[model samples]
Target: MISPEDYNRVKDKVITIDVRTKNEFEMLPHFDWAINIEFSEFISNYEHYLRLYNPDNKLIVTVCNAGNRSGQTSQFLKEKGIDALTLQGGIYNYKRKFK
Candidate 1:
């Protein structure tokens, strides 16, 4: 998992994927630059995401309201040879620290 501070330090060099549902993602406050890929869809169509956000040249950071789902997503990506990390404590921790 990546801490909020660490993520902020490399925010420009990474791709952040917000794995929340559409409703939650749209209604909640998330990093403006993050790409939303509802967890279920992301898991089902990971190949699409892998092609769009190839981790070969860029780091991928997964985030959810809390850390659970994002952590799972990160693990799944890693199993598929993608370098991915979960936002420590997810967006909640990020907001507590930086928002």
Candidate 2:
């Protein structure tokens, strides 16, 4: 998992995928640049994700309201040979630390 400080240091060099549901995402404060991909959609369309994000090309960071979902998603991506990391403590920690 990546700490908010570490993420902030490399924010410009990484792609952040927020896996929160649409309703949750719309109602919460999130990074303006994060890509909103609902967790279910990401799981269902993993091939599409693989096509878009290449481990060798860019770092992938998964996020959610808390770390749980993102952690699971990161594991799934890694099992599929994609290098992915979760935001430690997710957006809540990020907001607590940086916002």
Candidate 3:
């Protein structure tokens, strides 16, 4: 399992995938470097976004508002043979524990 501490340790080298709504991301405090894929957009325009991401540059970490969606996304990527992990408790926990 991916731990927040470890995530913090390697955050700079990791690619954080924010799976929250665009409005939610805009309203919240989060890592500045995180990439937003907004869940709805991800569902409707997945291929387009995937093509835009350079997954080779960093280790992938999928995160949702709460860990649910990220976990599901991570599982999908893993099954497709992509290297990815989820932020264990999502941004809510990040706000509580790290922010």
Best by TM-score: 1
What's model 1's overall lDDT?
A: 0.91
lDDT of 3 by residue, 59-83 (tens): 6898877799888887877876767
Worst 10 residues of 2 by lDDT: 49-58
Candidate 3 lDDT score at position 68: 92
lDDT of 2 at 24: 85
Candidate 2, 1-99: lDDT as tens digits: 999999999988988899999888899988888888898899899778757764455878999998898899999988987778999999999999887
Off by over 4 Å in 2: 53-56
For residues 19-93, what per-residue lDDT tens digits would candidate 1 score against the true structure? 999898889879888999999899999988778776465889999998999999999999988889999998988
C-alpha positional error of residue 82 in candidate 3 after TM-score superposition, expressed in Å? 0.4
- Highest lDDT against the true fold, candidate: 1
Least well predicted 10-residue stretch by lDDT in candidate 3:
49-58
| Cα misplacement distance, residue 46 of candidate 3 (Å) | 4.2
Per-candidate TM equals 0.93, 0.91, 0.84
C-alpha-based local distance difference test score of model 2: 0.87
